[model samples]
Target chain A: MSKAEKTLLNVPKIQADFPILHRKIRGKRLVYLDSAATSQKPRQVIDATTDFYMRYNANVHRAIYELGEEATREYEGAREKVAAFIHARSPNQVIFTKSTTEALNLVAYGYGLKGPIQAGDEIVGTVMEHHSNHVPWHFVRDHKGAVLKYVDIDDEGNLRMEQYDELITKRTKIVTVSMCSNVLGTINPIKEIAKRAHEAGAVCVVDAAQAAPHLPIDVQSLGADFLAFSGHKMLGPTGIGVLYGETEALEATEPLLGGGEMIREVHLGRASWNDIPYRFEGGTPNIAGAIGLGVAVDYLTDLKMEAVRAHEMEVTRYALDEIHRIPGVRTYGPEDVKQKAGVLAFTIDGVHPHDIASILDVEGICVRSGHHCAQPLMERYDLPATARASFYVYNDSDDVDVLMAGIRKVQEVFA
Target chain B: MADLRELYQETILDHSKKPRNFHEIAEADASAVGHNPLCGDRVTVYVRLRDDTIADIAFVGQGCAISKASASLMTDAVKGKSRVQAHQLFQLFHRMVTGKPGDPVNTAGLGKLAVLSGVSEFPVRVKCASLAWHTLEAALESKKEIVSLE
Candidate 1:
């Protein structure tokens, strides 16, 4: 079989791996299209976590016993897996945190607030950022007296590259952007943006919370100084995330939290810090979550990131084609599949998004309806809220048909 | 497990379609804006009080069907009631929507507001049904801050 055909055929097999897909919702078959919020875990990911607790449950990096050594090996092995997944220079470049929000805050506080940003320096960001990426810079601006500049997007939800170019001047200290919009699903040109930031003598921070699940990332080629993403959004467990920083950037950053593991030597009121990644992980980390995330990375690796991207592209293309057939429906983001990802944020005239979500819920179709944590982007488009359907590997044409039918039901009820 | 019919009743659909008293009151005595940061639903409640009695009430804003219909029905039900009675009604309505499963729904004196009893099943939407009532209470007290159910 052709590579494309094999990937398409794997959709059903992927669906079967997620045990939650077998359950019924409201007496009907479940049609989960909210992968952007969080992906359902497969049995392999679940069992890996369960096995960690049942067999080798011990604090890592401290004990010298057998179980403790095993736990430390698995935990560090997960960090290596994450480093390889993003093609980081080394495993020491990966730092584990609680969530994507925490990972971004680590960079914003550790790097931005420490010494890099001075008073009157400029921090350039885009309007398409999720709160995780947007609000942290606001803190830098508020506390450090740094200026914040936002690059606007076109009507099609594509960031204006010319405005971004103009925004990055010699005085710009940092340039932060999302690799893909959580709401619009517009894939940005991060390599070009990172290169421009570097040319202007500014550090580049990439928020890959949305991109890491759907796209193949090569940090070396992307030229980002730092990147962050959550494990839960990528079919791994919650409460664990990764921050990938270049060696120079990580060395310059100060630890946000001061605790046991982050210190090399301690005295009364003063201490020297540990190495790069260990210094960032202050406390005992989410050991089981990291192990499970390693299993998830292996799962995605076996499936091939290219196959995952192609499957989502096909599903999103099919959705875009059929969505135009429905009257009074307005969709956000770039219409071209090449420029967009799998998220579809839309509004039906004369019907509010909350009501639409409730209606879809009755049909056992799970969709996210709100600002999607992108209130700035919502305000840019003058929208109160929108109902969004995001796709993933387990979703296929059958799920899209169910969503289309459910939307018709919403219209008929409102009519 | 509640059916959609129980929540989006015909009266609710009608009121949501053609909401009554859905306009700003000119030179109103009291007004307050209520915001639900979750869904960006906002409603501004205006009240004209005459000696502690609600002489006129109106609201203007955008929200889901439940909120708009609830605001519309609230204006009609509390127009002639005193401030004390309105507060009592608000308390009763809040309980009706936020009641735990197996808790008896006390719809006494709730009248048309009883239709929102189905909101108890949808815990996430209770704020949508109660946003206007919270705004109305703020307006009655002449509070200056915007009411928020974040």
Candidate 2:
């Protein structure tokens, strides 16, 4: 692949962004398709991180020095960019957490743990969700004595929207759902679900961890009270995630972790929270991480969300068509690729996904095999596991073709 | 084009296809289940013990060729060995998979297992290849003929 061909997407002109991707796995060029797990970084994001460490390395929100002020400015400024990226009302609404997993847990502990979830109250979730979204709600249900409600899925992994409509009722205080299914690569109708949740007098929380990276998300348009997404999945850094919540709703929720930077008046016996954003942030923040996230958002915006969504749909369609044609290979998720993200999960006949993955690794075609952390969805389909190849802006049709070739090779070996 | 020779050796492929001791034993002393939740490879190992020695062992579950074959070969290897010997084999196999003791490790008694030593090169696959052995270790510890899937 030429340098120009690699830059067909917004993956930067230089290879220095992520040094890790350059390393050989089994002596072949890595065709990494596991971006759904975490995306590779860009030069700008990586340099932004280094720029902080070299010039402005200081603990944020504490020092009176100039570096601290500069760091805080950049960090909070990054939050503003993230807020704008998802069309949040203000930077105050963005709470930086470790990952989308932590963000969801924050909601579970901070909000759901608080009383509207009574002994008989209900919280609704879909069958297709990453464990980050699923586990936290189950934790709430078990601890709070709340009834857990689940929405069914179609044969192709799409959620049964009618069943979801029937389930979301006045008794439902929390209607948390994934904006997209990680394993199925199915993009859910989050705006419609959010509207329904609002109509039913329940607050809607969107697990946008998968969706934020692949599609356009307008939190205002979606009308979701809270939205959660991770930085790494969006071509940013790990240990940096965004949780978008309306100020009023966030105020009602208690902070998940307790420490400095989250309090207002500290007394010997008791303490009071600072405000909306500070209430959620309880410790020294990841300053450089936020800057990397800012550059990532800038990178995504430069490509334009509309183009990103369109390109992925095209890639998804090509992958689905090509992989489906391979004899003895079965694909999961929507055949009509426009209905989903670039993620595709499938299995080879008489070949377990692990074996397929091992074969693919030799060819330097990295794809995720196994449950994709949605065991419930696998059970829903009566499948033990799947081989998943997800695409991002960095991937193109050639990558899919390479993957198709790899799959054929796997079949040949097992056959 | 990338050659499979760098990764999947001929011996590993053969063992994966027609794995030894794939059938269940009529009588087993203990059992353990091995699960790689990442790949959803599940194997339940059953062992029959005659005093301190493993009288017979069998495994049953759905997994990739590597896991199934690895389990099959493992069951056969431990069927008649003493429990202490089986544990040592498990440790040695794990170390071999993780690339310890260099290129030509002492396979002195490992026999057909020497074929799997090639798996050491493919780091990600080590888990898939070792799934069966992890269960074997679990089966040895518990007196129950059947144990929980790891």
Candidate 3:
């Protein structure tokens, strides 16, 4: 087959891997454009979790039976796979949490509260951060007496590097930002920002919830001291998230929760903590979810992150060109498709986002409409909300066409 | 099974485009703000009451077409009604939009408000249609707290 033919053929084959893509909603073929919120799991990921429960379902680490040993190996093997996926220095740096929100909180409390952040210290974040990354720092600022400064974004939703340079200073103990903005889809310069933060004696944290599923992530190359992503936002199940911290960074922080499997020796007066990753994981982890996430990583690896990214960029370029053809459609994010992910947040003139969303819903086109948990960003732009349509592996130009048709329907209904 | 045309009727579209009584009441006796954090819809209801009767009513805010139209309809419905009558109408309107399984919906007194009965089909939009009424209730009761349909 020709290269173009091969690529076009792979799109349907990729769609086949995701079972939910075939389902109908509201009697119309489902056009899921909200993958940035949470991606539909592939059959491989689903089967991995089901297989674990069906074959070897036992408590990991505590029990000494054959089933227990198998479960432990599978859980730890998942960690190793995730470590390799992110190119972490070792598997011991990967801490499992419920979601990206919890993972970010683990760092905010475990690292910030323990000692890294002190009274009057400054913590820098961006205006484009999702609430998951924003709210945790608010707690640190409110309780720890640290000053929280937000770097502004330009009209194109690109980070204002001048303001960012001013925001990060010697007193800045930590600088946290999202690798890719969930709303604007701006691909941030994490490696450059990490270098700047390091030069200023600040540890850089990255919220990779949006980027991990789209871009090729290398923690070592990115130089982020701590990185976090959710499994559900990728192709894995819910209730499983990864927090990849540098070995030194993980060792320096305290555990957020205290319970079984997290401690080495409980002396009644003072308890000794377990090793790096286990110490952060306080209780019985999400074994099934972890295994599922492992399989998801394997699946993505087989597809090749580069190819996936290329496909998304192609789809995004097509969407941008087509969506712009609709008069009165104002899209947010960089004009250059290369600078952003497949996510597109936009507003139709004279139409409320909720109304747009409802109109699209009738056509079985799922798009997120609201402030998108980034109220501060919404306030920054003086907008109530925006209708966001995001693309993923299974999505193609046809899905974008359906979305355009739905949007035209919204205009007609409102007109 | 829900129809979009039913939700966005002709009267609704008209009211949403040129909402009635969509200005601030300068000499307001009672006023309260209603906010729907989910969709960022906000409505401020103001009432100038003469004894128990609403002498004048107005609303000022930004929201979706349904919410803006509902607010406009609500102000027109409750303007001349007494406090008791307005409360009763609020209850009727609420039930109509919510479509409570057992509640009786009497639309005889609801003129333009009857158009909003279609909101019942779209359960998620009930909050949008009732935000103004909730604020009106709070205003009539002279509540100082902001009304939030969380």
Best by TM-score: 1
Per-candidate count of clashing residue pairs (backbone under 3 Å): 0, 8, 0
lDDT by residue for model 1 (A1-415), tens: 1113334438878988999999998888999999999999999999999999999999999999999999999999999999999999899999999999999999999888885778999999999999999889889888999999999999999999999777889899889999999999999999999989999999899999989999999999999999999999899999999999999988888899999999999999999999989999999999999999999999898888888898888888888888888998889999998899899999999999999999998889999999999999999999999999999999988888899898998899899
Per-model chain A TM: 0.98, 0.95, 0.98
Can you list the residue pairs that collide in candidate 3?
A: none
Off by over 4 Å in 1: A1-9, B101-104
Interface RMSD of each: 0.9, 3.2, 0.9
Worst 10 residues of 3 chain B by lDDT: B100-109
Report the Cα RMSD per candidate. Answer: 1.9, 3.0, 2.4
Top-scoring candidate (lDDT): 1
Residue A198 local lDDT, model 1: 94
Model 3, A77-176: lDDT tens digits are: 9999999999998999899999999999999998888757899999999999999998999899888999999999999999998887788878998999
DockQ of 2: 0.59
Model 3 lDDT, residue A286, Cα: 97
- TM-score of the B chain in model 3? 0.93
Give the runs in model 3 whose Cα sits over 4 Å from its true position: A1-9, B100-109
Residue pairs with backbone atoms closer than 3 Å in model 2 (clashes): B29-B47, B29-B48, B30-B145, B31-B145, B31-B146, B31-B147, B33-B149, B33-B150
Which CAPRI level is candidate 2?
medium
Better of 1 and 3 by DockQ: 1
DockQ of 1: 0.84
Candidate 3's chain A scores what TM-score? Answer: 0.98
